[model samples]
Target: MIIDNGKLNKQQRKAVETTEGPVLVLSGAGTGKTRVITDRIVYILENNLAQPWQILTLTFTNKAAYKISKEISISDTSFKILNSKELWMGTFHSICLRILRRNFEHIGLKQNFLIFGEDDQKSVLKHVITNLGLDIKEYNPFVWVDKISFEKDKGIQDKYSNKELNFDKIYTAYNAQLARLNGLDFGDLIIKVLELFQIAPDILEKYQKQFKYIMVDEFQDTNAAQMQLLQKLTGNNFNICCVGDDDQSIYS
Candidate 1:
């Protein structure tokens, strides 16, 4: 038996009951967005529209993911939803990390690979510059590093024609160093996962089949790369629901 918390209004209830392809719920703050999401999970399970393991829920932050998990546990008294191993819920990067760990062999990544932060990333760039025998002042570590990051985010390799410094050489060396260390920076988390999906169709198909339903919170905040990932995930099932408010979206 499913229980309705009676906290959602008519419109929110409509969203919860919806069972279709590519749903978008746009609403302002204090409108029980999170409540509706949890209720929607219950609705899908109660109606047998999807199994717990077949549903994938992604939040932008760990806090949002935790809140959803807590709410589901509270709302579902039997704890069947909470105890299900098939259920997948986490931040986007964390989810990608889990996938990478399981299928790292296919993507040529170590299962125990480390993720480097900004400081570590800068350190790697510095090493690359030093190894190339270039002076740090002329090369400008911070400026070049920022450019490289921008290029990575855009999913393209950028070139610069500064007579004294070679951006391409620096970029190539930086990537090689990262590969040697078996590490990935924050941006590569999503980029490499997307690359895996493109290069390995069978693996991508497995996940597409595993997750029959996908829910994304803070959709408006999603950048181009994130949107591409969502597109690929939902291509087969088209059972995606994004909940966010345009007005509240701080990220472009």
Candidate 2:
């Protein structure tokens, strides 16, 4: 239920207002991307198509989410009512943090665990290779530790496909380090959630029910981890929409 702003052509109109199933919006610049997103939320609220509780929007950047919020508020204040502190619009990492924070206590966290970005994760890896008796001189931890992040981006753990090993001890030690410190590195966010989902279907089901309309912005840029996450969010009900220029994807 998106407003047919003069900005969207007929095809764009279908992409914007599409109310059911998986949707892929492939378009280039000047194709009214933000305009369509803004109008879509506007249409949903204005037409009463979705209960204020059911429309969940996911954006790639916090800045983008804020902008969408600002634009939608212009149509009516009721738009403010849909803001899901844990469910509505936000970056993948940001939203995952919310979910993790909710369940952190179950995992023995005494407080909200820290969410590390890429730079911080590198430091963790560097420390692990050094502290766990690996020869950094020979290992060149810096050269390959970044792979952890990339692998996590694709939802990969130790890859049998790649056939790299000998770090079982080091890997466990690093995880122990994060656990002792009550922190999570950037890669942990998605990978941890995937683990939690596997172990806790009930928890996953809770989120699935909570986010009624699953919309992903910049979807083509998403990697394997994010692609799996998208599936988890949408469930089998198919109330999902993905908008991105597939040609622009780097992880592909």
Best by lDDT: 1
The list of candidate 1 runs beyond 4 A from truth reads 1-5, 77-79, 138-145, 155-166
The TM-score leader among the candidates is 1
> Clashes per prediction?
1, 0
Off by over 4 Å in 2: 1-7, 76-87, 156-162, 165-167
Tens digits of per-residue lDDT for model 2 on 198-220? 77889989888877677777777
lDDT, candidate 1, residue 44? 85
Reference-based TM-score, model 1:
0.88
Span of 10 residues, lowest total lDDT, candidate 1: 156-165
TM-score per model over all chains: 0.88, 0.86
Model 2 lDDT at residue 39: 69
